[model samples]
Target: MNLKKHILALTLLVSNFIFSQNTYVFLGSYNLDKSAESIQVYQLNTKNGNLNKITGVKNIINPSYLTVSPNGKYIYACTDTKTPNAGSVSSFEFNPENKTLTFLNKQTSGGENPVYVSVHKNGKWLVNANYTEGSVSVHPLLENGTIDSTAQNFQYTDGSVHKERQTRSHVHSAIFSPDFDYLFLPDLGADKIRCYQFDEKQKKPLTEAKVAFTKTNLEAGPRHFTFHPNQKFGYCIEEMAGSISVYKYKNGTLQKIQRINTHSDEIKEGFASSDIHISPDGKFLYASNRGKENNIAIFAIDKKGLLKNVGYQSTLGDHPRIFALDETGKFLIATNVNSGNVIVFQRNPKTGLLKKTGNEIQMENVSCVQIKKIKP
Candidate 1:
């Protein structure tokens, strides 16, 4: 009986290890020269939030933002640049067998300084936000995961209240609505969340939606936007203004609900807020505050769609550029751009709080963490 008990326990442990999912972490980064590798891949252990380096992709310059397709067969990156006609978007085939990326093709983004890129759930179109030239563009994606060409584009010329930072239109992020019916763009320089009707089934896809655009408070400088899992509430993290603006969302239209500051009262100077994302369950929201207070501001979302400050936690590094939660929402990885490290934190699902796991992945200027789960 004793031998049988030990055998049963050992067999169960091996079965669990084989059945567990392997998560692939793709780190986007800034590459100064062509020789320096920019994109790094790692396998994150689910048992503990530890990252093991897998491989690195070189020759791509400054992939500031990355998005994986729904099918997990393609990876898209936005090349961060300022020179006119130089900014671009690149697509690659994600090989699951060896965990490597193969160059597919590249297309010119509508304008300079392409900062963010998001893909349609159907995998038909890839949208990019141009910061320096204040424009947005959409490209047709191939069935085999290669990019074809730019299909449609829009340019925003207006500037906002900030004299230096808001000198002209800066398109920060372009994200598809929950149902993939509309495309919402947050323009930092224009202080607006621009809306457009998107139809990937058409010959030429992007067009104006029922409501062309929604305006935030003047000088708000909306940088990033995230939708609730329920699809009724929307949140925008303002960059220059350092606040989160809540809205009631439906059919590509956003109606203002409430607004709250992400920084504490003591944080008066050097306010720069970067990214925002809600938990998978939609019970909590997280926003990164850069500049003076380098920490992530946590908030709880009540049933009424209102936000209450839960707490703030240190990022253990400078300039938390972007962060993402795992598939299970059990762990979070934050990329600190200035401090050149990516830190992992264990999350409590019940309380929606983060505790650093003390496992750090040292890198060079990582800007984004895109998580993909590998299924057996």
Candidate 2:
């Protein structure tokens, strides 16, 4: 081999090795003051399941939820939460090499209390769900990591059985299907999962699907929706009912296959289930419960796309509003919103079990957790 060519090849190998050893973790929280830091960054040691603090960004109010762009160069967050008619979505440019986020721009969320934000696979569209106003907003994403003005907005006013919690529509989450051709929005107050067809090429990419929506149990209150890795099944977590509904998905249509309770039989009232996620290998599913049980329910996935309850793991703190599994499925991070702690658990891939690693961080009101493995 030539001298210069050999040296260049060796440098590339070393760079790849370094990138494989670490992943980046982004945290979002509710800030007491507008000037306080609402977002934090950490470097995760993939080998040992430990996190090292990187930096924190301030001046953005209530960045309670965050999503990274497909290319991992940009982050979009729902901001100004709980502020009447002042909800907004902000964009930031992320530099993975330095583990920093630079604020780019912000746009109105079209409603109040924007709770969830999701980016399409093509990285050209962004969507958010407003809880208080029960609306969904869509925007065009520019190549420079800044978000354009809202291109479309939809509002709903229907309510369900619950007198207090379901008095009106409460759109909690906006999630895209695995193929990026459909969007499923879980409405907590309406007890419905609204379906939409998406085409990035169109001026208005979001439209109602043929089957408009799927109704859940009378007072289920679906909060978050997620698709299985196989793309044939979908899961929705019910906040009020404390149950997880399994659905068969096809062509943007959802058919309820199963509805199972997420809480134990000992507890009856105050059911508040929060988030749901499947392992990368598609062998297990995990859901978080907040209200009386601060634990995660683990289920084993059968070949027919059904869930069998395996066991429950304590979150090691209270109010586990959100949790995320690392890309490699080696670690799971759970954020306790009420207890103000972040706990890391070592995952057993074969058995789908989680064990506490004694690795935890303290941060008040931490509500969201996201992990991304960046490549050089």
State which candidate has the highest lDDT: 2
TM-score of model number 2: 0.95
- Per-residue CA lDDT of model 2 for 77-155, tens digit only, reads 9999988769999999888667678999999999999999999998999999999999999999998989999999999
lDDT of 2: 0.92
Q: 1-376 in candidate 1: lDDT tens per residue? A: 9999999999998876653446788888877666776888888887787788777788888888899898888889987554456889998887766877887888898798899999999888889999989999988888888887888888989988788888888989998889988999999998889998888888678888878889898888899999999999999999877999999998889999999999988987667999998889888899999889889898999997889998898899999989998887888899999999999998888888899999998888889889888665
Weakest ten-residue segment in model 1 by summed lDDT: 15-24
Error of 1 at 281 (Å): 1.3
TM-score, every prediction: 0.95, 0.95
